[model samples]
Target: MSRIGKKPVALPSGVEAKIDGQTVEVKGPKGVRSFTATDDVTLAVEDGALSVTPRGKSKRARQQWGMTRTMVANLVTGVTDGFKKELEINGVGYRAAMEGKNIKLSLGLSHDVVFQVPDGVTVTAPKNTQLIVEGIDEQQVGQVAANIRAWRKPEPYKGKGIKYVDEYIFRKEGKKK
Candidate 1:
């Protein structure tokens, strides 16, 4: 019944997948990643592809079937192409710069916000207003971008703040004079 689960994840050339019980490990040119599925689902590598199947007809099993399959697919993509997130500062004085392993952000605050870059992720600022977050782990890349954006969310009126490059801010009408 799960459309996503029914489709097998194809392993491209130069990418290798290993299965050990409920855990699946994938290694590619970019990096290596692994995922452990719950006992409600089964993981198997067959014919240069990975598949997930529920162990029973229970609701939990069906839910895990799809979720587990997606997780495995993410692991493969993470190890191969990796992930990236882009953010842009919109305020006049707001800007971002890389400081060694940390990022220095000026978001119209009293003091510059220093964000320490965590391991396994890289943050770069090609332009003062643009920030690029890249990492092999999709979750880490997204979380880092979110943490950076949380520092200065775009306002509805002026739209002055930090936001994703593709994000749109809903503007509101100003108070009547």
Candidate 2:
């Protein structure tokens, strides 16, 4: 009894969804993306709508079926709306630059650190202190942003380092003498 998988996904105008065997290809005005449904999850396009049907009510079948549907829906929406993540450098002299398909960061260390960017992901740094990660895949976009933030996490005491714009660092007050 999966509530979400039971609902059909309406195909927006200018968006085309088709099934090629086990893979579902969705093409929209923004871009194109595809996904292969897992076992027990059937994908079909009917009357300009995409639907996912579970083979049975077993735990594995229900879980995979619903997960596949959610992932497929995300893939379709990501290609159309795209995804973005923003990070800020808090420490003084900490900055970043785009260098040869990699992001070069100087986080108060003696040497610069360079992180290679995977294919299909775009890293934009309008300002050295600001980082913008954009991609069609939501998972990739978020993972890249998290990895970048992990390089020099913000310290609770000083709150200096790389962190998301909305992230909050819980600070513990110093003990009184």
Candidate 3:
């Protein structure tokens, strides 16, 4: 038996959940989100909570059982509190600014890098060296942050680049004179 799949995902206050076949939809104060599970798993809503179970004892069924449960839980959390990712720019002459719906980044490059914000997600630049990404879907928010960080990843030597607020950069020793 799957330990994670055994526990039901409780519906918090002001949050509603519904299950139609293998699809689970959740609505909350923030927004609404839905997820479709594989055929190896079964979905149901009961006792003010959502639950997932494997249709068979096979390996794939067991895998789907846990994954489906977690997906449903994520849907509930996304609809309720949503997700957020923060990035910090650390480099000389490196900064970020918002232009309409796009973000302009200056990572010590000759030309400024323009990143267009995607739909269902919001990007904000509170400071020239800080960025905040928010969205109802956790995956989208994370992916957007990753894409932004890819433009200027932190260097081990000087630790000068873009990175997550809570991330740590491993430094390397300089060559001997």
lDDT of 1: 0.92
The TM-score leader among the candidates is 1
Candidate 3 lDDT, tens digit per residue, 93-140?
A: 999999999999999888999999999999999999999999999999
Q: Work out how many backbone clashes candidate 3 has.
A: 0
Per-candidate TM-scores read 0.98, 0.90, 0.97
Backbone clash count, each prediction separately: 0, 0, 0
Tens-place lDDT digits, model 2, residues 1-177: 888888888787888887887798888866788888877888888887788998877889999877888887887787678889999998879999989789999999889999999988999999999999998889999999999999999998888899998888897777689
Clashes in model 3: which pairs? none
- Candidates sorted on TM-score, descending: 1, 3, 2
Residue by residue across 1-177, what tens digits does model 1's lDDT show? 999999999999999999888889899999899988999998888999998999999999999999998998898888889899999899888898888999999988899999999999999899999999999999999999999999999999999998999999999999998
What C-alpha lDDT do the candidate models reach, one value each? Answer: 0.92, 0.87, 0.93
> In model 3, how large is the Cα lDDT of residue 126?
94
Error of 1 at 127 (Å): 0.4
